[model samples]
Target chain A: MTENEINHIFQTWLKQHKALLFKIVRSYAFNEEDRDDLFQEIAIQVWRSVTSFKQQSAVTTWLYRVALNTAIKWTAKERKHQDRHESIDVSQHIIESHQPPDDRLAWLYEEIAQLNEVDRSLTLLLLDGFSYKEMSKILGISESNVGVKINRIKKHLTTKSEKS
Target chain B: MEFKEMKKIWDTQNDEALYVINEDALHRRIKAKKMGTKSRTSFSEVLLIASNLCAGGVVIISHLLKNSGNVAALTMGAMMMFVGVYILFLRWQRIKRDQQTDVSILGDLENAIENINYRIKLSQSMIWFCLIVIALTMFTVLNSDQSVFNIVLISAFFIVGFIMSRWEHKRFNLGKKKQLLDLKEKLINEFEM
Candidate 1:
């Protein structure tokens, strides 16, 4: 595809599906700097995916695959860099600027921030209402495994909500 | 709150925009990122290939200019040119392989790990490459009919170069290579109970 064509499709997808990206960012990265970093990384990955997307899956699935993969790798890499960290790059200014958040949503994100990387991905999928089959395919786990994970995560979130 | 209520709150974010994006900035950054990623990933290979090719070119040009009979320089020059071609071929193959889009997150994670492993290996090989270059230089210098003082100076120069390369290689592996391994470990062990 030509550059303009890729840009058009990317903009369309971004306009249509940015809420999903933001949720993943919030769940994966807690601080503003981390959020911006994750956002930029995901955006770049998504843009790169635009060319390779053959539409075998929904655009949302493709975006999630690319974005989640980037976020997971990035989160791990950031842990290594966190100790000898420099200030945020000027790329920090690219995508995300947060507004005041809803208290309940903020609480939910706080809870998500406490989960492990794999569980965090499962939570995003489950809360986004992806089916067990879809989650299994996306995560490369068996459907039964997806079911078991979702049940455990739901229970944990429930217990935490009640205690709070 | 029930799971149903929690689901409802999550669903509320479906149409709600939690974060504002700057589209103009995003466009600019994405273009720059595409360009940056290309250069950043291939910069080392470019440097290696270009330097080797330059070494080969200089050797050939010197022989032509001086009409000298230097068998060692000619052989080393051919070897450097061969190494440059070999690196180019390997890079082309990798680029071909990386173009395919994997179908799942697990596949993506595996690809990322593989790419990092390649980088780690490349960094390790680079230190070795430096040593080989220094050894070759020393061989050439030793074969030359230079004054004893000139031979000493040349040997000292190569020795210092080798030491500096060793330090740089260690520093690179410690920072970037260690983090890459950590990320790979995290990805592979992500599902562990």
Candidate 2:
């Protein structure tokens, strides 16, 4: 396909599925500016890879794969220099900017941020209503492992929510 | 907070659906992206280019400022240029590999693995090669008045470079290469399935 055609199709798909992109961003990033940066990064990756996307799988499947991979790599790079820049108070600006109107969704993200990296990703896929098989495919894990990990995360979150 | 209740809550949320793409911002982003890829040479690649330029400069300077018949200076400059050219050739191959548009997951995985391997090899070799050229060039340029201080400084540079390169080699293997290897193996298993 030509570049314009590819751009048109991607814009259409992104219009419908932007929530998926935002959901991944919100889950991976702590604050609003970070979310914006992650959103931009994911958008660029998708745009760059759009031509390479064959319809062998669902569009959502391909998207989650890219989103998860980018998030993992981006967060890894961020963590590498976290120590050097940890003294500055970044969270103050974040706090001023990120007052989510919805408390439940905020709490949900808080819970997600508490999970380990792999579990955090699995939870995002689970919350997006992916099947165990699809989660396995996206994550390169066994189907049974996805089931086991998701169940553990669910139970842990449920217990925490109940206690609180 | 059961899974079903969580799913219901997730499905009910419309607050997040409020975000819409602004065409102007997207156009700007796309333009910025085009610019980024056009100049996507990493810091190391920039260093390689700079080193090549410096080597070429040394050859010109040797002929103009120093004794035109100084064979050692000429030979060292020539050898440095060869090293620079070889390193640039390796870097170009890496850049080409990075730009390949392979859509399949397996293809992407293999490309990532190869890129990591290329990085490991490049880091391990470039440091020693550059160090040798730098030491030789320094000695040739300052050979007229070789003070004890100059010799000590040159020896110190080599020692520091050796230690840092050794540290980098270990760190790359333990961290980046190991992670990529695990991911590559998992990807192969995934594709096999």
What tens digits encode model 1's per-residue C-alpha lDDT throughout A1-164? 99889888988989999999988988888787677668877998888788788888988888887888778878777555432243334654555555666798779888988998888998998888788888877877678877877889999999999999
TM-score of 2: 0.62
Best by lDDT: 1
TM-score of candidate 1 versus the correct structure, residues matched by position: 0.83
How far does residue B146 in candidate 2 sit from its true spot (Å)? Answer: 14
Predictions' DockQ, in order: 0.59, 0.20
How far out, in Å, is residue A51 in model 2?
5.2
lDDT of 2 by residue, A91-122 (tens): 32211232234677677878888875567888
| Least well predicted 10-residue stretch by lDDT in candidate 2 chain B | B184-193
Chain A only: TM-score of every candidate? 0.89, 0.84
Candidate 2: residue pairs that collide: none
